[model samples]
Target: MASRTPAPRQQTHLAVLIDADNAPAAIVEGLFEEIAKYGIASVKRIYGDWTKPQLGKWKQVLLDHSIQPMQQFAYTSGKNATDSALIIDAMDLLYTRRFDGFCLVSSDSDFTRLAARLREEGLTVYGFGEEKTPKPFVSACDKFIYTEILRASPEAEPAPSSEKSTAANVEEAPKPAAKPKPQKVPLDFIAKVLDDIADEDDDWVHLGALGQNISKLRPAFDPRLYGFKKLSDLIKGHPKRFELQARGATNGGSKDFYVRNAGIAR
Candidate 1:
């Protein structure tokens, strides 16, 4: 089988810090699944007031995921103690120089400066938040993932009983998972980037390199936002506007793929 791209020899060690004050318990399963694509989560920590009833939903989830909970009491009515605690911990983790990156999970914009600081120190930061997340927070990270695309695992299907009618069994079959709501593809951005970076002599550009450039230009740019699984798929889905080429593959190993504007005429 021809691989899409060569895999990195090593995964980035990441510090996964979550602000439980804003993020929900539902996305925990999907959140980690997304994280695996980048690297190992060496440190999984969530900051919140565990005593609050609102946080009760996260208790079992933390245990299941082996995420250590840091308790921070709310000392004032209007202040957010959890954010302060998480920020301090993130700084401490950054100073350790043990992690290759950080995954900050929250929809709140307060962590914007923290994300900017991490990038300033030369560590990659991945921010996870809802679509409502402020642009400042989204752009501060290396790549931002909208939690709207993340989903909880579906409950297991019940086994069919000998006593149940066939029709009933058919009716009870699990419904297909709901897809994330589609967002408009940044077609203008994609076209401009292709022209700016990899229209080399008006030739094809390596897909991997193109992906990196796209992330650099727009940290929150994800194919999932437009309902595609990969950058290549996103390009291919717009065949009228973009073109692709697969080159340099031997014996079912990884292949070097290239992409260019269809107008480039290969």
Candidate 2:
């Protein structure tokens, strides 16, 4: 009998397109950090007219991050030409068949259709926007990241002269943003999901597989939303509802985590 060779994992290539008017310049650092988790960002582009004063802050950030700028003049009052420019470029990029995924950055709902179209072509689409973004746009992507989670911490304050608004509105004060309180974790919902995926073995499941299943059911499900940096921590916090076990790695790497319903006696 011959030993079978394991298939190599394919690297994901991503094209990150930002709507500068709707996405804040402040999220540049955290945005890239989060994108790195999924794949390499091969194309980084921001679309907006440089002639506008509101876009001035983005200029410095763009140069620092090596993101190419797409100039699109606002041809008519109350009309957004940037969206059209981005959509056209997205279609062109899609036709090339290079990128494995796309990360669309904007709070505007206008890009919802573009997101859906990209997914229709069988490419993964990740959306980055503010919490105020419409549900239609949020649901259009494989995953959605809120820019609020990407902002620099309040403790990392800069000199008075350096303080500036990097948000969409570009508020003059640059005050520490007041975020909403963390929402209560839906333990019942999680238990229900676990029950559906569990086998005859007391509903136990590998944590990684559990997370993937949860993502399939709720695209926007993230532990960060509950003030927990990691999913394990989030589950640990709810000791009454869930149980965890850390299985040592055979290769001396990090321990593997598993979770099961606390209600069941093993």
Candidate 3:
């Protein structure tokens, strides 16, 4: 019997470019953490006029996070020299074909065309910006994440109100409840994609393969956006709509997870 050859190790290498002028310094920690979920950040660079006092906060954190600050002095009063510098560097990097993807961090719509152009060359583009970022820019990338979501405290919860109980207390007006977050990835969408990609004979799909299909179908589809850390956990959340099964691995030592539409008979 011949020994089986191990599968090739495939990992995505990403170039992270930040517009320090438009993005906040506080989100740097969360931004990198989020990027790690997709792949390793091979190049981390931030473009801005480092001499300006406004970027002082960013300067303090640059060395700590190992982010390279590219200084582009203001050439004119109104024209944005930082944007031009970042764009030029991005194109240069793209031509090198050293990165599998690029992470463009900025709320400015000026980078919208840049993101689109990168995607045209068959490289994945992940965008990070504030919620107010223009729709055109958000839609241009393969994935877009709001920076506000990154800076949010995962353990933080609404504080309880304190009120003194008194005999003279009258009926108080009802306070409006906080609005629930809208589902970023709809259950229907997941189900439809699973059904479309499932094997006809097997009637089941590997959870890993399903995730890839989902990304291809909806470039911005991420489990984190829906409050789940992993795709398996996300599918498990919708137990009624999907069925998960654990089978022995191909090597016969461990287990592999698979899923299928709940309505489909095993």
Those runs of model 2 whose alpha carbons end farther than 4 Å from true positions after fitting are 1-9, 156-173, 248-251
lDDT per residue for candidate 3 within 1-266, as digits (tens), equals: 99999999999999999999999887888899999998999999999998889999899999988999998999889999999999999999999999999999999999999999999999999999877788788889888887766773544445434565444674454443232353565889889988888777887899889887876666556676677868888888888998999998677587789998897754
- For model 1, the stretches where C-alpha displacement exceeds 4 angstroms are 1-11, 153-179, 199-202
Candidate 1 accuracy as lDDT: 0.89
Model 2 clash number: 0
lDDT of 3 at 90: 96
| Clashing residue pairs found in predicted model 3 | none
* Candidate 2 deviation (Cα RMSD): 5.3
| TM-score of model 2 vs. true structure | 0.87
Query: Where does candidate 2 have its weakest 10-residue lDDT segment?
Result: 157-166
Worst 10 residues of 3 by lDDT: 173-182
List runs of model 3 lying over 4 Å from the truth.
1-12, 76-78, 152-185, 250-254
Clashes of each: 0, 0, 0
Error of 2 at 250 (Å): 5.7
Candidate 3 lDDT score relative to the true structure = 0.85
